[model samples]
Target: MASIPTILTTIFLFFLRSTISQQIHSNPDCTGRWIHIRRLPSRFNLDLLTNCSQYPLFDDFCPYLPNHGLGQKTHAKSHSWFRTDPMMLELIFHRRMLEYPCLTPDPNSANAVYLPYYTGIDALRYLYGPDVNSSAEHGLELFDFVKEQDSPNIWARHKGHDHFLVMARPAWDFSQPLINDPPIWGTSFLELPEFYNLTVLTFEARAWPWQEQAVPYPTSFHPPNLSFLESWIHRVARSRRSTLMLFAGGGGVSATPNIRRSIRDECENDTKNGTNGGYVKLCDVVDCSNGICEHDPIRYMRPMMEASFCLQPPGDTPTRRSTFDSILAGCIPVFFEDLSAKTQYTWHLPEEEYGEFSVFIPKEEVVFKGLKILDVLMGIPRDRVMKMRERVLELMPRVIYRRHGSSVDFRSNKKDAFDIAIEGTLQRIKSRLQEVAVL
Candidate 1:
């Protein structure tokens, strides 16, 4: 007799194949891209939620699991908010997908398949403290199940080109190289054969145009509807910013993490806000000097709401969640690396190029050529600054997950990050399949 996990896995694959096979007979009258969300066994998603407190990161993640992974309830002055943990994106993405527009109950109607697997959550144990050789266990297990499916009508259909999944972690977490002496890093999920063809949405994707695409990281502001978003945008536009720039992060005492070490050093203690002897200082720094903002994401957001360009030097990685938080606060981001925003978020930002909403100062200039960031930003015309802020305000709606359980009833045509991501994924898959059909 098969064990429970194996039995459940087989049943899931059976349902998946049948669901997809039946899509051929779905109502053609339905317009728009129909997304077929796969029902993976609870072991992949719901089971993780059930054991949230046991998650490797926090002692108790149950609070972060409420409101559909939006985190513990938090607010400011009668407003609805959540203490959204950065790592809870898997929970958030899965819940938001349930509210995904154009979701099809009938598999045959699906133009694209969304596998709601919690690869990010499932990968924590392996990534945090497990042996390096065991890093690929969860991903390998999931891959084996998919590979065992005998459905020529599902995975084999277009060679899984129409299938997609959302990984809450950065692309690097899943693409850790399988070296003989594997370092203490991430899992080998993307390295597996089963996932290579599928579309993946993450907070930070690789700069390359292979399978992964960058999506916005979640912020404190999850608007209930289009009206709330509009209200916020208007408020931000009317906001009286008091400084030339803002740098609300840390790398001050030590310079090992961020590539823009010199920038952090320069901004760490810049106290001259308005002017000193006809000299305008670069920024108002909120130095989170000693890991001060870990539990307090607001330590970054409140200041960002009142500042212009927010300096976003790469931290530990080439990208930072602070970038999206800046956008949510209507602050134009100052990027140091092209890959941090320019190339990774092609599906959403700029509408064309990074210049449409951000400012980029090459890391080389700051690290090697000894260029002063203050001089560069202060040199920009006031008109250009206002225009950039306006662009950032306009982009606020595209970078959040607005529709919560109650908000799903608050009907509006606005598409948030999740919506844009799904549409983009479907379009990319369709484009690829068309090219294949031509051959």
Candidate 2:
């Protein structure tokens, strides 16, 4: 019933709207997401690194603090690998925040607030000893300092919901158990009411979440620039993946309820049988018993580089650092459970189904139902596998933390793990703030 001009205008409007919708789904819109980073006292962050040797924990963290938490640079031939520590995520994130494009000095105009507190090292004092009084002393002191330092408009505006902090350790590291069940597991930093309200970024969040969001663990590979990252992707894509599976972890001795032992047993069985289950020499392994692979990365990296799928069973916690490491090697990850990664890294990785870039085999199916990993993997269509690998290459940059430098400009437009985290956090807070405004 409409005229030709009206029909043409309507069609054009529909096309424009559809194109905009596609763009919204493809590109992350970071409009009006200015972040105000609150300067915490040196004692909470840099001071902890200064006396890293005297901490209640393990190794001297002084060496890890240099190179902006990337750790000592390695002989990066094929990759920009580093002897990166898992304990320096706070600093890595801090450095990224320092170089963030939307960082604003005025808190009044800020959409979110960043609290760069090194809670991991600060909580190290309570990690070993059976002391509960000093468990959350640093965290409690931090809240007191924040209350004294910042304006009421910043934290008080949304009751710490808009404020976030990054801790290199998992939520469990700071979440002290109600009773001394383990006696010396973690500090009580996360247990406090003040910390509960703040949005926390961790290496691994609790499977059942409160406010903690899981980010990627620091892998050895950190490309200097986008071109370097692109080159790595192409190199790995072209590399011959002779092996089907790669596993790097301790062979569990306790056979009663062991995931690793089961995997190791199956892997060894497949390898030993020579041509079992319609496959030949299917799996490769890097024996990581006694923390060998943790220190020497190349042991696992070599195997992962030549493998198609990397088996990622739950370690001490639900997730392992090797998950990201395998991705760096262009190996598609095989997750045993949802909590391991499926539910953890929603922001950085794809938000759609996990099947796009990974293969998930339920742990129960393997442990109880007698599922053979090689059989399942070998059965997948080659085209699907290639598609998954291509998807992984596409997603490689999102999982990585690109090394920050002075040479790169603010609008360099390379979106890595840090950028993803910031964008995700800003959008999350924006929605929360809108809900608050509505109420």
Each model's TM-score? 0.86, 0.87
Which residue runs of candidate 1 sit more than 4 Å off their true CA positions? 1-32, 55-60, 76-79, 129-132, 147-152, 255-259, 268-272, 276-281, 289-291, 406-411
Per-residue C-alpha lDDT of model 2 across residues 283-341, encoded as one tens digit per residue: 87787887767646778887888888999999888889998988888899999988899
- Residue-by-residue lDDT tens digits, candidate 1, 93-180: 7666654556676555578877878888777667653444677554766655555643336566667788888788898888766662
Using lDDT as the measure, which candidate wins?
A: 2
**By TM-score, how accurate is candidate 1?**
0.86
The TM-score leader among the candidates is: 2
